[model samples]
Target: MPQLNCIAPKPEHGSTSDPVEGGLSLTKMSSESQNKAVLAFPVQPKPLQLPLYPITLKFEEVVYKVKSEQEGFCCGGTWGTKEKTILNGITGVVCPGELLAMLGPSGSGKTTLLCALGGRLSGKLSGKITYNGQPFSGSVKRRTGFVAQDDILYPHLTVTEALFFTALLRLPNSLSRNEKLQHVEQVITELGLTRCRNSMIGGPLVRGISGGEKKRVSIAQEMLINPCLLLLDEPTSGLDSTTAQRILTTIKRLASGGRTIITTIHQPSSRLYHMFDKVVLLSEGSPIYNGPASTALDYFSSIGFSTSMIVNPADHLLDLANGISPDFKHPTEQSENMELEQKSLRENLKSSYEKNISARLKAELYNSEINNYSHTKDASIRSNRKAEQWCTSWWHQFRVLLQRGLRERRYEAFNKLRIFQVISVAVLGGLLWWHTPTSHIEDRIALLFFFSVFWGFYPLYNAVFTFPQERTMLIKERTSGMYRLSSYFLARTFGDLPLELALPTAFVFIIYWMGGLKADPVTFILSLLIVLYTVLVAQSLGLAIGAILMDIKQATTLASVTTLVFLIAGGYYVQQIPPFIVWLKYLSYSYYCYKLLLGVQYSEDDYYECSKGVLCRVADFPAVKSMGLNHLWIDVCIMALMLVGYRLVAYMALHRVQLR
Candidate 1:
């Protein structure tokens, strides 16, 4: 038998202290003779570089309140409003070169406090939050990075492309392209994401990187800016223990580099818990404990809550704060009595902390820090001046977003399902109305109407799903101040034009020749142009609906009803649509497209036999005159106006929804 021994640094000080030499031993035995062997592997130490500008975040007496509605069965289910306090007098300070963990049970205001510190909270916050002795401002926000609980990224983009795009939009223009690329590459290596740098970021349907890798990519994105303060929410919520430990290890290394790192964690392993320099134990929106992580157990034990050697320290502290002792081994005690004792213990601990040593020390620290900064002049002006400058110009933002949007749309427009759908519809429609007879006025009119309706229905339905799917990513990016809403909306709307027109162009060319309406090249081209414009109008309408509702199912339902109404009012199903409701036909883009196509095909001299050659009548001119579609150019202009109008409305809707 052979044995191998390896030496590793102790986990306690390994996270924060410099590297030190350790002892090692190894033994190996041979089959025929007694032999021994030893192997040594040395780990070189690399000193972490401190941040250029260090920052310390302190919050005192922070209270957040929200107005919530309560529904009661009284008076047959009436609703009443009430005010609820979420965070009550939370005070803490996170210094540089330390990792702080906010631990609590569910609904304990951990996330709320994190959001408050990150400047992302929307509720009424009354408190004094200062960064290095100055009040929090936009400059503070620009230098701070927040990683949300969920990973919100573009699934279609590869990891390299996603990070590169973010770097372009987020890094300051003063840095050259080579510098930005170098920074991104450095971050990739730091987060251990170099292996998956070129892999696609897949979602539930697609398979790409693992869950832990995706989370790393999310962290790597924020690191590219080299922010002074990094805040993360539940960074290890759904990850395996091994992956979770790796993420925490990376965070610890990042903290050692002099960045103030704060994160909310749930039930971390004992080894993982040792990495934090400080911990804030929260219960029911209140801080139960706020001090050094290593002294937390001692503080609890001193207050009469003792733990056995078998219980994990982190778990014991959470259970005690949450009023449940899962590790209690008393078999004789009733559940009711145990619960009552737990509740009493929690209340006593909360009261003791408020009036005890930790609270007093915190108050003194806050006062001293406040006094230290009161004498400085022009502090805020210097900090905020640089923050106000945008990372890139408006034109640069538009150009980058336009390129990304076009690439995404090109991939989406030619996907298997979408291509099959477009081809299927074109093939089926062509076969259904093959080689129509011009003499049969009824059949010819029906075929032309179908052509208009098909293009309208197909594009509108697919566009309904666009905004909803991207809403989360849009909101996340907007909150980060990466780009403006108008820029994104404009890029998305216009970037889709080339592909939007391509599909319909192919459809109309095939159906126009197959259906054989008017043989003239001018007429064919005119009909194709009319159908193309109508498709754009329909797509714009769909975008508006999606932005307004922001829900796929609801938007789909509304779009369906709108499409049906337009089809009915297209002036083909029932020409005499009861004068009161006939105005709908005027609003229908399909109606205009149909009228234009017919006018292009027929002139004043064109005639049709009414009853098997019994009488040849000039139906085209009469039909055009009665419908008031004699001016084909006017219809074309109206359709174009509708396209632009719908897009404007969609833009407005998206702006309102996103800002709200």
Candidate 2:
């Protein structure tokens, strides 16, 4: 083959190049070779020309405090907590077309301030935050998008699937599904994620896309809505230098599209640091320096903190934030002197920032507010554009979430280990019971009881881990106002039915016949329905406990104890109880379900050969008599109540989980 130079293709006529599998095709520059070559390198398409909703985010005197226990005579002479400040009068502004970075070490309240700006934080917050000269409103929330520090994505979902699902739920109801999907495509292209568009977003166990790509996917999810004010918490948390730089570059391009971008960065390399338009350096929850990125060094130097040419500005800034001079390296220095000097540096930085930057910023904010008031029409138009409306209908959200959940959880629900566990138990139970005769009333009762106990523990343990595993993802999505909690809860409650029922249906089909308890179709169908109903009730109880606790180990432990109690009082292992605790059987759903199963399998007139030739009613038998198969409808009604009741409890518990 002749020598050929592969040149990245540029958009023609201000439109993106024709997209290929992984990316756009590379154009051959050599005359000797006329054929085009395909290159897998991701080439960012021209920055999307999305409709700009210019937002000016401003916060004045933003203060956040948390309760700290203190031994003090307060609150009517009782010991009370004191308010501990987290963010101390932090103030700044990020206008449209600017990339502002909040730089600080751990626990400096960078994330807290970002959350306050995004309207995601609520606890003793005293501040005035505005978007487009208006206070933070539902309209502002709808227009703003917040990307969390961790990539809270479904590991099993492909890049396109994740963004598409986000778009389906988050995009306004005015837009058609096709239009929403088109937006997802645009975001994928704009972020240069076309190469990994079909790749899975992997977790710790399952390998999928790269770390950088996962971060981009997180960013892309927010970008799907074309948010005006985007707040990202440490978007480059765990990426390498090159990937981090690329991410910053992409963010800079986004800012160029007239979107106000605020991101919290723990530490950034010099090259990555320069990509930001403005920098806010915080120290111990106080603003040390707030100014242009290029002029941060000069501002700090003017404030009596200067760095040498060899030192990185970010490193030097962090050193100053820590109350240590960047040049301080004297190991033999006196400890008291170091402490006093460090305290003095912090005081000086805070005072200087207040006098120089904070005062000027306040004046600018005042003028901006005045200007915004003067131009009432512009403010009205912006407000009209940002007007909050239900993004998607409840039904639409439910459908989308249901589909996404099923797709994301298929592997977990049907993986080899889970399938093996269910199948092995089914086979073992089948062989052990192995078609017992109708005369063996005790054996049949034992088998039915074991069935109830198995489902009770099985679905409960499996479902208890649901919310804990998804708590972070849930918080992240809800904070963005993507979907109603009702929609998510309903979708989750119902979505797992098919996946959860499939195995039990199979198990019932196999074990019921293999054990040969009931040969009649009516009886078999009723038994199967009761088993499925019990599974749902157990799953609902698990959901409730998980939502109530939101801790995996704690929820699992509680679920185990609860199941053990239900199993014990289920009228199988223990029938007779003291009058005080006899009511416990009524509390156990297992008791009701087991009674229903027996009622269906054996009728009142059914009899078995108890003593070879002597016939006796099945109901008169000890195990059957204790359960008393009478009131079958009442038993089912009680189970039905539990099916709905437990889910309602789960929903109520989840509601108490603050979305803010």
lDDT of 2 by residue, 13-83 (tens): 34442211111122222332212222222232332234545666778899899998777555545376788
TM-scores of all candidate predictions against the true structure: 0.87, 0.89
Q: Pick the candidate with the highest TM-score.
A: 2
Clashes of each: 0, 0
Clash number for model 1?
Answer: 0
Tens digits of per-residue lDDT, candidate 1, 567-589, equal: 98887777777888878988988
Which pairs clash in model 2?
Answer: none
RMSD of 1: 10.6
On lDDT, the candidate that comes out on top is 2
Candidate 1 — worst ten consecutive residues by lDDT sum? 18-27
lDDT of each prediction vs. the true structure?
A: 0.76, 0.81
